[model samples]
Target: MVGVMDDNRLYAIGEVARRTGLSVSAIRFYSDEGVVPPVEVTAGGHRLYDVHAIARLEFVSTLRELDAGLEDIRRLLAGGLTLTELATAHLSRLDDQVRRIRSRQAVLRTIARQHTEAEQVVLLHKLAGMSDEDRDRLMDDFWSEISEGLQVSPDFLGLMRNGPLVLPDEPSAEQLEAWIELADLLRNADFRREVREALRETFSGPGAAMMTSSKMVAAFERGGVIMGRAQEAQRAGTPADSPLGREIADAYTAYLGEIAETPDSPAFREKLAADVLDIERLHLESLEEYKTSTDPYTRYQSLVAIIDGSARQAAEFMPFAWLSAALKASVSP
Candidate 1:
């Protein structure tokens, strides 16, 4: 029952508690904290709240149940804050928490699968938290280092530089694992050296001079056309020593000569045939490394494929094989 003094009605602490479902002690504490101060106090120091104060206490109790801080409730009660602002802040906090939780899940999954050390776990956490820009920058630095003083084809170098693991807003365990492995591989000094040497031996050596020439762009375009013809011939199962095969081979050799800035000759054909054979050997060795050796470049490629959905079928080497045979058959017996 409301107490009456001078024809004004007010609620005692116990009465407000009973109505609002807050404890008498909680109402008293809220009053003490000025979050819901009482409207009156008697000579006996008993607290009493008016209808407006009791309503304020009810609202404060509701806010408390919703996890609002006392200071925030104070501001809200004092009309210095709006519900929209509070909701936005809480939503932002929830989004951050969700991201952190997902990252933790990914890291734990990685750790469980790998049975890594504590330091490794720490590193995993850092990797999971990396921003997209930071991730791209890390890969960019890696590509820059490996491509330094190296005349890599623009299209090929662009592929290397542009390939970055795009972690989802909530990354899956597998995605995160792939990203971690790829990042570690990219940062590896030995892996960098391995790639640099391999690129030089495989790509930079055979066509290095042609790529450096002023007409290299035109040469590459012309080579593409020549290679396209060779690929078509191979696809049709044309015999390497057939007239059509020889005709395409003549054009292919001519394009190579133009790129090499030399005339087509018997000596050039023989040397190039042997050089192409050596290239095949190098390619086989590299493939074997991917299959059997501890070298992680293959792992790097696989991880990138996972991240970017570029994990298509393996490159068809039949074209190279056909071209090699055609090059050999074009030589005078």
Candidate 2:
């Protein structure tokens, strides 16, 4: 035990070691490094620490174990590291390190389970670098590029313009597989041509453009109204065939027919029909291509299947169908 003098100065190095759980040599080394200078020396020439020095020494040991450099620890002990700025910088660095470690861990787990090759490591790294938004943007650009020059309706274009991919933060193996497959498919020229052709079909007829736009709007609005009414009807126990219900239904059907027709012109109509057939064939070809391609990554197959099912259903049941019926009812004897 280093002696404690009567003036209340902290005793020699041994006392600091017992209190800080650091070795006496470590305390002396830090002092020599100017990390935590000793407060004073005794008559026998033993180094002594004040209460403040002892506390600072303990802080040095803690910081060092956390991978802080000795220089940084020295700055901290010397009161040069302003709490706000220095801490903020360190915290950011720590967060980045943590994320990198986690990403590596995830890749290692994949390799262990799947026995993947070197190429898989590169792929995993690429994926780790991609944010959800970035991934979606890549897919959107791919679809838009391939689908260009096809006369798709504004509604379909709008749908495409909105992100088509839906990868979650913690994506599943299936989802990751789907993303890779989708990316590969987007690069295929034949696939692109097919998608373009199919999309052109809806824009082939006279007034096709006008019809598509109007139908899209009418369908969306009518659907919302129908849902509200359906809820009300369900609550009131009223049959959906009531006068109010029929009016809503009829209006919806009529709108559909209005968009599907153009001002009469037999020659133009014939040309339009031909264009439509070509577009349909092209689009169908793309789908056929998908069928023949190596089974898409599971993620992509699931994503496309879900998106396609919902989209096709919406197109078929668009409220414009009801509008068409209303227009027909008004004209009949």
Candidate 3:
């Protein structure tokens, strides 16, 4: 049976505890702490609580259940803080706690999936602790190191400055894994050397110099026209040996010849093919390695574009490779 409420009612400590579902000792403790001080003391030394005191103790119980600190509860009782203000502050703290818990859960999930050793677990935790700024700086440092002394254009430098491996604020398991692999790749001496070599190959040579020259911009525009035609042909399923394919191939070969400062001859075509093929091999190898480190299903389109456009110009040369092979074969003695 519930205790009856009355404005003038005064209850013994035990009776108050029974009504409020708080332990008698808890009520006494709160009274002693002046959190919910008793209204009076009986002649027998028993604490007696009035209706107001009972209500205050009940409110304190609710706050304690909500994990409110003792000092905060005391401040509220002392009229130093409003309940609304304290609740809002506590809610914010709870939200922060929830975010921290979720982050830990995400890190633990990653560790479990990886079946990491102790050392690896420690490293993963360290990686997870990195702030967004830290990650961005790390990526920038990697790019700066590889690009040291390279004659990159402003446009190209901008593309490289904004790198591909951006981890989301709340990253998924796969994204975290990608980040881990990417970090390893960035730290790799061999990978750095490979990137440096690719940069040199990309920005050097007569062809590279021609591409950068303002005088040769018109030449590049002409080459773009040929590339557009080749793409159309490719979409139309035209074979590389077809007359249309041969025409596009010839136009492409002439463009390369002009860039390389060579006459349009079978010998020059062969030499150009050799140079491009080597760089193409290196680019393909690097792309494959990067692909292995990331989620294949989730493409990093921007990063891919940067790598293809700046490092290899794979988009430009993939069709060119097919065309070059056909042109070389046709001009063979």
Residue pairs whose backbone atoms clash in candidate 1: none
Q: lDDT tens string, model 1, 43-154?
A: 9999988878877777877777777778877777788989888767767777788778877887888888888898888888888788999898888887787778777556
Better of 1 and 2 by TM-score: 1
lDDT of each: 0.73, 0.59, 0.69
Q: Highest TM-score, which number?
A: 3
**What digit string (tens of lDDT, one per residue) describes model 3 on residues 1-333?**
975788787888888988999999999899888888889998999998888899889999999999998899999888899999899999989876765565566568767777777877776666656676877777777778777887755445554454444454445444555455455556667767777777777787666654555555566568768867866776677776788866876777778777777788777766765665675577577667655544321123324343224323454445555655656665754
Best by lDDT: 1
Q: Write the per-residue lDDT of candidate 2 for residues 169-262, one digit (tens) a residue.
A: 4444444444444554565676666655555664676876655574675576665575455345445554444565455545434443355564
By the lDDT metric, which is better: model 1 or model 2? 1
> In model 2, which runs have C-alpha deviations exceeding 4 angstroms?
1-7, 41-45, 65-69, 131-137, 145-151, 164-298, 301-333
Q: Give the TM-score of candidate 3.
A: 0.54
2 versus 3: better TM-score goes to: 3
Candidate scoring better on lDDT of 1 and 3:
1
Residue 75 lDDT (model 1): 79
Residue 306 Cα positional deviation in candidate 3, in Å, after optimal superposition: 18
